[model samples]
Target: MSTVQRALAVGLGAALLQVLMVIAFAWPAADIAPRDLPLAVAGPQAGAVAGTLAAADPNAFEIITVTDAAAARTAITNREVYGAIVTGDGPPRMLVASGASPAVAQQLTRIGQQLSGVPVARAEDVVPADTDDPRGIAFGVMVLPLVMAGIAAGVLLTVVIPTVGGAVLGLVTFGVVGGLLSMTIVQGWLSVLPGPYPVLAAVAGLVSFAVAGSVAGLAAVFGRVGLGVAALTMLLIGNPLSAATSAPELLPQPWGAIGQLLPPGAAASLLRSVAFFDGAAAAAPLTVLAGWAVAALALFGIAALRGARTEVAAPAEDPLPVG
Candidate 1:
């Protein structure tokens, strides 16, 4: 084969490989929905009522009995329960935590209207998210930053150094920078986000590492162009498809399903729990993120180490009869 033909074939093969890698990560042709969500019930009398309500709508709201209304509200504040139903002698009130999910509040209102034939008053304890921070929506900002950082790491590897060297640098970067970011978050350096300090720190660290590792892995599998594919994976396909700004419940058919497997989707869900809710429901999301990161890192490490091109030494002709 001609030199140009060989080069073209290798390049095309690398490009296709990168695309497949992305598809494997971002595509989830499976189901994605919450089976149970934590819900605190305030009044003892509310047990039957809330239980009945939940039974009627088995898909959402897992009712957990709290001693009193105050306690229930506190649970919501601490991000334990998504919200509560506080029943008093006067009238049963729905305590909605807008921060956890404003869409839930809307759903509750609709349900209330259906049940009572009148609009039941709602007490919003946890308010809706800030309008200013685009990133804060569904913890997308937090996840996006890390994914972008990872793609950047991949680029640095392919462009500035050998694939193996670049991957090593990416791993180190994830470890060092991620740890430092975690410390800052734990120390309460940023006030815009109101979740637990430790949770933020841990999440930031893990996410950073995941992004970096994924990028490195892609670089190892492909080449310089692999960086582009990684960007498409984490940014264009992952971010846009992820229900970060829009709740999965509200999204359209394909995008909603597609979003579930993306790093942003997985990480954002976990982060929301850490930041806005008690860690009770974060296990699944955390596990998903961990799995992806670990898988990417393992594959990258193996390929970068093993699939290396051997250094070719030029043959020297014997000095013709030692002139």
Candidate 2:
């Protein structure tokens, strides 16, 4: 085969792979419907309501029977459930947390309205998205640029610095800059994410660190290919799997579980916890980020040590002869 033909084949193959990945990550989400989506039910008629909803569409909701409307409301605010149905003598009331996932909230509301054998009185948003970005798209999508910046920083720092200390310095510097910049755009300028500014900035910083560390570690081990791998893992798989546009349970099967385990997914979940749930569910995701950062740091050390040993073993070039 000619060199030119081989190159063309490789390029086309790469392009096709990218296209397929995009379709795999995005196309299915276009016409999203509930799939074991968490929902709470309250009052005496809760069992009947759950039974009716289940009978209609068995896969639509994962119902949790709560004692009362107060408990149901608590579940929504804590982000324990996406929405709730409250059954009483009068019309049934639907409560939801739009802040957790606006799409899920809307879906639950629709389901509540269409529920058979009982009239749905009203659908209320217990927790809504920030005023500036009511739809919450910005909150989810903005993480893309932040992750990209982290990846770039990781690769560049590893290439230029080479030493573990220098790499640490680079990571810290980039993380602070990225975090502050992100906080400014989301909170200061747009007011899409509400203060406390310091808390938001800290969350951003952690995300930056986790992403940067992972990329740098990969690059240290695999060179250029590492960067591409990191990009694919974080952006292509992590972003859509994170369920930023919806809830994790709404995602298809194991992809949802896998997404939550990745850095991008963990970061997104942590931010949501801080922003809407008052940091109630922050512990688990925070631990996930910390674990990634620590593991990457270890990788960085190994690479640095290996490079140093190679330098020590290599024969020195003969000094130029002086006249």
Which candidate has the top score in TM-score? 2
TM-scores for the candidates: 0.63, 0.90
| Each prediction's whole-model lDDT (CA) | 0.63, 0.82
lDDT tens readout by residue for model 2, 1-323: 99999999999999998897877677648647778888999999999989988999899888999999999988877777888989897767888887888888777777777763355445788988888877888987877777777777887887788677888888988778878888988888888886478888888988899898898888887888986788678877877787777777777877777888888788888888888778867888899888988988888888888888999999999999998
User: Which prediction has the highest lDDT against the true structure?
Assistant: 2
Clashes of each: 2, 0
* lDDT score, candidate 2, position 167: 87
Worst 10 residues of 1 by lDDT: 26-35
Once model 1 is optimally superposed onto the true structure by TM-score, how far is the C-alpha of residue 116 displaced, in angstroms? 5.7
> What does candidate 2 score in Cα RMSD to the true structure?
3.0
The residue pairs in collision within model 2 are none
Root-mean-square deviation of candidate 1 = 7.2
